[model samples]
Structures are given as C-alpha cells and as structure tokens.
Target: MAELYELSMLLGDLEEQLVTCMRCGMCQAVCPLYAETGRETDVARGKIVLLEHLSRELLKEPEAVKQRLENCLLCGSCAAACPSGVKVLDLFLKARAIINGYLGLPPAKKAVFRQIMTRPALFNRLISIASRFQGVFTRPAGEILGASCARFESALLQDRHFMPLARIPWHAKMPETDEPAGPDKTKVAFYPGCLVDKVFPDVAKSSFKALRHHGVKIYMPANQACCGIPALSSGDRKAFMQMVRCNLELFADKDFQYLLTPCATCTATIKEIWPMMGQYFPPEEQEKITALAAKTMDITQFIADKYVLQRKYDDSVDKGGVKVTYHDPCHLKKSLNVHVQPRTLIRVNPAYTFVEMDEADRCCGMGGSFGLQHYDLSKKVGNRKRQNIYQSGAEVVSTACPACMLQLIDLLSQSHAGIRVKHAVQIYAQGLG
Candidate 1:
C-alpha cells in the first residue's frame, strides 16, 4: 500500500498546479481520442479529476489512476486552450514521475529504456539487428504507402502496418560533422533524434541541405542518445535523465548560437519538457538545461525566421511535380505552436504542389510511447488521420515527426494505398539547386 504521507507529499507538490485547472472542458472539443470513444475518461478534464482524487486520497488504486492518466496524448490541447492557464501536460508528466516512483515501469519498457536507449552503442546495434530481421516478421500491406504488417500475431506487433527500419541508419552512413559557420554567417548544432538518424535519414540529409543553403554552420554530434521522451512518457525518469545528461555533456562545450532538430518531439521535449523536469538536476546542470532550452529551435522556425526562403516559382513551374499534403504533429503544433512555418516551407517548394489535407492539425496517434502502451487505440486514432490523408487526394504525405511518419506509413500502407511520405525540408531542399 502506498503510504499516506508519501502520496500526500506528491499531492502537496501538485496542489497549486491542480488549482489552475478551472474544469472549462474546452479540451474535449479538440481531443481526437475523446471524439472517437466519447468517453469522459478519454479526455483531459476527466483525467485531471481522477488525478485530483488521488491527491485527496479518494482514488485508491495508484495503478488504476496511473492507467487513466497514461491514456492521454499529452498533445497540449488542454493547456493550449485553457483560460485559467493550467499546465495540464506539466501535471501529467509530474504525476507520471510520482506514480513510477511508487510502482515502477513494467519490465519490458525498463529493459528498452534503461538498457537499450540509455546506451547509444547497444541501442544502435539492437536496431541494426532488428532492421536486418524485419522481413522475416513483417509482410507488405501498402504498396503506394510502403507500409508493412507483422507476419505473426504478437503483443508488440498487432495489426499495425509500419515502415521497416532503414537498411543503414544515418549514423552508420554519416556518423558526425563539425563544420565552421560559413564565412558569411552563424553556427548551429543539429540533433536529428533517433528516428531521423535511423529510419528517416533522408529527412536529416534534406535538412542539412536546407540549413547549409541558409549558410547556417552545422555541428552534428556523434553517439547521441534518444531524446528520452519515450522513456519519460513511460514514467521511466531514470532513463530519461540519463538521455538528457548524455546530450547535455556532448553539446555543452560547443559554442553555437542555436541547437536545432527536424523532429518535433525532440524540439518540444528539449525546449519545454526538459526544463520542466529540471528540478532533479544539480545546480550547474540545471543552468545548462536552461541554456539549452533557450537555444533549441525547430528547423522550420530557424529557417523561416533566421533567413528569407529563396523562391523562384511561377504558377506554371514544375506543374508536373508530385502532389503532397501536410500533417501537423501534436508536439510541433500544440506543444511549440509551430504550425505554419513547416507549411510555409512546403509553399516555398514550387516543385511540389502543396495540397492541404483535411484537419491538417490533427494528431496522428503516435504519442511517443503512448502507442506502445495502447496500440489498438493508437491505430484507431491514426485511422482518422489516414482518412484525412487519403481524402486530400494527394500522392504524397508530409509531416515533421519521424514518429508520425512511422504511424502514417503504417496506416496508409495498411489500406494498401499508394502515398509517398516526405519531410517538408526534403521538398524544399530539392528546389535549392
């Protein structure tokens, strides 16, 4: 049984933050999962109430309470629209830490986060093996989408279709770089995150082209760890802390005006969530986090804001270009409020006609580790996004998150659809030369 005092102390910490929530229920309107299930428990307000109950000692099962809290997308919708200015994501993350402190993460995630992700070398090797053996387990599901499904039933591999790991993750191809700021301009560090470095190396390569085109010097580091969003969301703070420390150490000495990432999750996590959880760090480390958080920027924001995009398009130019639509990742849009710049980058690419997908800002159901904990629900949520993607009638789909890329590819492929996936930078970088 969880002690009253310990739970009480956690409740004490949550007290002020909880009071900010006025129960306005605005979160219900935009929540994708709540829209599908129509379950109050699925919405942010209901989850907040359940958490309040635990704080007051009314809710008994910490496990049950934890389960309800875990059901959320952490998309920041509630926080975004909130009038009373409640930090819902903050509360959820803290509550996760408290609950995990009491009950601990499950064995499998513990292994994955603590063992695999915390160690960069081992994680790379493990993914390398998984990439090699992928065909033995998965079969083609979407030709146009290039998605695949599990060959056999398994807990981890359900009916979801997904992009198989790249044959050579970007790390193996281009381990690292340290180029000086061009004679004309500024320097920036780039953290591609795991998915981009591995599955979506094209995204990284394309981003490099775009950044360099802007005359932004690149400082790509080697032996980088996962951003730890997957681990932290699963309530594994130890692993998450390890990842932050690892990245902090690698980039600490480098003198750069900005640190950037193509992945929305990494941008959001490092900029927002990292400092939110900085209470656990030492005084000096906490300062380092503050500096890092202040400096990190999404690639689109960096490009659109730092430099003027070069455009040489006429209505008739590249009329035969690929048709593409964009999806706004929850982290990129709701978390960091970076909705338009990516699309602007799309607009800059005259080679591809930028088509607007239905509900372009909707979540694609790849909520970090939320998919792992709830695959069926994740796919169901992703289903709406797939319809929106198809309904747009575009031949290609683009998004900023590699996690979303995997999810979209899976859903698009599952329907046996033919939709190519591209990063916004990939589209824009092509027009540079």
Candidate 2:
C-alpha cells in the first residue's frame, strides 16, 4: 500500500502533461492498434484518463493500468495527431517507469535487460554463440527475405518469419574505424544499431559505402551499447540509464560533425528519447547527452541533406528500373520529422523507380517489443500495411528502419510476396555503383 502511494506520487509529476489530452478522439483516427482492436482502452485518450485516475490515487488496480498502457504501440501516432499537442509518448513512458519501479519487472525481462543487454560484451558474445546454433532449431522460411521459422513448435518463435542473426555481425567484420575527413568533407560517427549490426550488417555496409561515395569520413567506436529504447519501453529505467551512460562515455569528446545511423529507431532514440531521459542523470552527464543528441542524424537524412537535395539528378538516366516503394518509420516520420529526407534519398536513386505506396507513413506494427508480446494484434496491424504494399504493384519495398524491415519481411514472406526489403541507404548505395 505504501508502495502504491509512492507510485502515485511519482505519476503525479506527469499530471500537467496528462491534462493536455482533450479527449477529441483525434488519436483514434491515427492509432493503428485502436483501428484493429476498436476498443477505447486501446487508444491514447483512454490511457491518459487511466493515468490521470491512477495519479490521483482514485484507481486501485495499478496492474490493470500498466496492462492497458503496455497494449499501446508507442508509435507516436497519437502525440503526432493530438490537436492539443500533448506529449503522449512522454507521459506513457514516465508512467510506465513509475508503475514498474513499484511493481517490479517480470523475471525474464529483468534478467535480459539488467543482466545481458546492459553488458555490451556479454550481449555480443551470447548473440554470436546463438548465431552459430540457430540452424539447429530454425529452418529457412523465405529465400528472398532471408527469414527463418522454428523447426519445431516453439512458443517464443511462434509462426512468424524472423530474420536470422548474421553469421558475422558488422562489429565483428569491422570493429572500429577512425577514417579522417577529406578536404571539404563531413566527418560522422557511425552507430550500427543492434538489429543492423547483428541481423542486417549489409545495411551498415551499404550505409558505409554510401558515406564513402559522398566523401564523408567515418568514426565508429567498439564496445558500443544498445541505444536503450528496449529497456526504456519495457519500463526498466535503471537499465536504460546504464545504456545511455555507456553510449555517452563512448561518443563524448569524439570529433565528428554528426552521429549517423542506418536504423531509424536508433537515430530517433538518440536524438529524442536520450535527451528526454537525461533529467535523471547528473548535470555534466546531461550536457554530454544533449551534445551527442544534437549531433545524431539518420543516414538517409545526412546523405539527402548533404548530397541528394543539393545536386540535380538527370531524370532520364534510368527510366526502366526496379519499381520500389517506401514505408516511413514511425520514429523517423513522427518523432524526428524526417519523412522528406528518406524519400529524397530514394528519388535520387536512378536504378530504382520511386513508387508511392498507399498511406506510406502508416505504422508497420513492429513497435519494438510490442510485436513480440502481442503478435496477433501486431500481425493484424501489419496486414493492413501488407495490403498497401501489395496494391502498390512495386517489385521492391524499402524503408529506413531495420525494425520495420523485420516486420515487413515477416508480413510479406508469410504471404509469399517476393518483394525485396532494402534500406533507403542500401538503395541509394546501389546508385553509387
């Protein structure tokens, strides 16, 4: 009971943001989960009201509130569409931390987030071992997508087609680099996010290829930690802070004009979430985070801004190329306002014809761990995206986020759609050839 009181007080700190929700139901129009579930509790307005009641100590069941909050995709659709401009993501994230801090995280997550994920070396070593033995338990599900399914029925693997861990992760291939910036060229610190590093190292390689083609210098540090979104979203604030501090120590005082990443989630987490959570750290540590966040940029954003948008391309160079469509990542589009830059990167690729998919900015339904927990709902939301992609009649589908790529690969592969999934930077990199 005392703990509940503490939780309520902690949640009370977010009351100002909670009151901003006008209950206009505008969030319903954009929320992918609500669209499928058709439940008020699935939308941001209902969640905000629940948080409000809990903060006031009027709600007795903190568990129920936490469940309702976890049901959300945290795609930022609600916050993006809110007329009152409420910070929905911020409110939910903080509320989650408060409640979970009181109730305690689940055993499995507590172990993974606190034990394995927080330690970069151990995390890498374990994943590397898993990669070697994955074939014993999983079988190839799709050739084009390079996805695998469990050989036998497994609760965790389920019926989803997942990208197998890379045989040689990006870090293993090229642990670190400190290439100098050429005359009149920009120098960037490259961060290959977990998925890109382990599952899709080619994306990292392609991004590096694109950077080199554009005369950009590179600096990548070893022993880099996860961006901490996984921990933060799971309500493990301690683990999240540990990861942030780890990354801060790595990139601090490094000479780079911008921090670059191929994964949209990494870019958004660094540029937005890191700063939002910086308040928990000391003043000096906060300054380092703020400076690093300012320097972060999505690889697509950097290339498009520095090169593609500035140079006029000859449209007639390649008329009959692969028909490619773009799926905008929620973080890149809503969180960072980076929709234009990724599309610009695609349009400049002469080897691919840029075709627009219906609702190109619709959420892909991955939502990080949200997909793992509520995969039935995740697949339903993702099916809508699949229909749009199929209807586009494009031979290839591309996105800036590796997480979205994983979701797209699973959805498209389940239906036997032969469409290839590539990062925008990968497509742009092909043009360099």
Candidate 3:
C-alpha cells in the first residue's frame, strides 16, 4: 500500500543510525523498565531489533512493534549508557512517528494533540476552567505535600495524589514582561513550562525572584505554548511542529542572551530535541530553532555558573539545619549532562545542609505521559525512588523538573512519608532573601 511505502521512507532516515547499535546489552544495566519487567522486549536492544525488522519489512504487523516501542519510559537512560553511542532515544522517537503514521493515532489522542494542545489560547482557557471546579471533585489528601486526591471513585483520575492547578496561573498573575538588562547583567527569556505555570506557580515566582536578585532582566511572553515534548513523545509530529512554530514566533524578536526554563524537561526539549528535529522545518525556521537551542539553559545552570561566585553564602553556618536532598531528573542529567550545576546551586545555599540520596541520578520514572499511560509500572519505579529518599533521612527532597516533583509527591503521599518536595530554584531563591 502507499501508506506502508511512505512509512518505510520515513523510517529510512534512521537506518544508518540504527545499524550502529552493536546489541551489546549495556542498555539493560541502566533501563528502568527492563529492570522492573525483566522482558527482553522491554529493553532497548529488543526494541532496536523490532525497529530493524519493521524497517526492513520483515515484520507483518507493525502495530505489534509499535506497542512494544510504546512500553519505554523515553527517559534517555539507554542512550546515556550506550557503549556505541547509538542515539537510542532519537531512533525510538522517529520510529514511533513512522509506525504511528502507518497505524494512525487513536481518535482521543488525535483530538487532544491537534485540537487542544497545539492551541495555546484554547489550552489555557480549558485548564483555567478545570482549575476553578477541580475542588468539587478532588480533596486535599496530603497536607504536608500539598497534593489532592479524587473526591469520588474515578477511573480517569485513578485515586492518584496530584497538585491542584493554581486558581491564578503564573501567566495570569504576571502576564508579560520585557525588562531590559541592568548594567553588566545577563538578559534571559524565561519559559516556565506548563506544570510550573499552572500547578506550581510558586516555582515560577521563585525563579523570577532569583533572577531579579542577580540583576538578570527577563522577557516572559504571555500565552506561551507547550514545549511539544508531550506531543512528540506521543508520536504526533504535526502537533509538535505546530507548538514549536508557535513558541518560535513568540520569541523571534526578543534579544535575550539566554532562553532559560525552570523545568528540566522543557530546557532539554528546546536545547536538544528542537535542533535535532530541525530538518523537518524550512531553512529559516531551522536557523531560528538552532540559534534558540544554542542559547537555552536550565535556570540552575545559569545561576550557578554566573551568579554563585558573585554572591556570598554564610559559610560559618551551623551543620544542624534543615537537611535537603536533590533528585536529578533524567532530562537534566542523562539527556543534557546537567547533573553538577543543580548541586552547585544547592551548595551555595547556606541555610540548608545538603545530603546525597542513594542512586541520586536514577530516573524517577515520570517520563511526561509515561506516568499516565502506564501508572502501575510508573508507581513501581517511583516506589524504588521513594525508598531511596526515605533512606536519605532528609526532611525535604528537591528536584529540577516539576514532573519529577509530582511523582515524588505521589510516592511519598501514598506511603504517608513526611518528606516534602520543592524545586531547586525555590530552595536557592529562599537563600537569596
């Protein structure tokens, strides 16, 4: 059929990259899903085999191969540990697009991605409406964690503890700004990703405070679109491109030194994924995306590198203080190699004593939509992370990604553990006061 021919053509782009995988099984040692399920098909090597079969037309049912591919967390663990430097995540994303194009996305996903997610104004309107009425269906479940649970039995919500949407999201509170850089200071264009904008507005506020204290000027546009990872990870390339263009157009004329985001996932998507997928766009658009990607920085990285030495931390502080531990989101650590900067930010905050958790860089298993599509598997991986946090003996757990914070809250709340979750920027911002 013509559809299969097109699918093969799309998959052919990755053929040269795919052959580089030597099937060394090094990925199994780092894969979170493979450790939990222990299935060959769940590991990167097995999925690579399936992709090769489909690309060569050796597999009859591409849908089965698609299903096997969707089982991954997209955490980039295998790619980070790959001996041959296979670029496994890149191959998996493109392969998903190829196979999903062949099989067609489900009606529900099609509607959400195309109709709602790609449109910023419509998405904000719907989320605002949901925030106003969420209390009627959800009740505060974890007072210390500040999370909520379903008021009644609901299959969609799954009795999971979640952060309620802020009645006034960050965009609604501080709509737009074009603050010029102060003398000898860096100017940044801030992209507070969806979770920070809606559910954790305080993180956005703290980032603003920290940036302001360092005399960094900001250009924050209102009605910014999603970073497209949710769509791209779901294999909806059309929706992903739409979101990317929306953001690129909004940020086109702004002359900022850096494009910073408080969310690790968003920073990684813009810096790494955008440029990697730029070949799909027009040359001009590709140029803009590449330029923007070059300037993208995680908030912690920006502050730690530029501002840490400039400021003074009270070095004479007592050891007996509020103990804190940090969780490295996979996108920040494995994807972008940003493990040290967040720790550096924490170290510069003298009010809190930093403690290292066991396996600090392990994936917390909140691969964006991975938690929603595969909740049981997600929870299993999260519980292992929770045990590590518990063993760390810290009262507060800090992480760079809002998604990781959500997963940590769920695991701690379900187990009735007393550990609280905060963004690294939030902790660093407090010490700035």
| Top lDDT hit | 2
Q: Is candidate 1 or candidate 2 better by TM-score?
A: 2
> Could you list the CA RMSD of all candidates, in the order they appear?
2.7, 2.2, 2.3
Of 1 and 2, the candidate ahead on lDDT is: 2
Note the Cα lDDT for every prediction shown: 0.83, 0.89, 0.88
Better of 1 and 3 by TM-score: 3
- Residue lDDT tens for model 2, 373-396: 999999999999999999988899
Q: Estimate each model's TM-score.
A: 0.93, 0.96, 0.95
lDDT of 3 by residue, 368-433 (tens): 788898889999888789989989888999999999999999988887888889999999998888
Tell me the deviation in Å of residue 425 in model 2.
0.5
TM-score of 1: 0.93
Clashing residue pairs, backbone N/CA/C < 3 A, model 3? none
Candidate 3: what lDDT?
A: 0.88
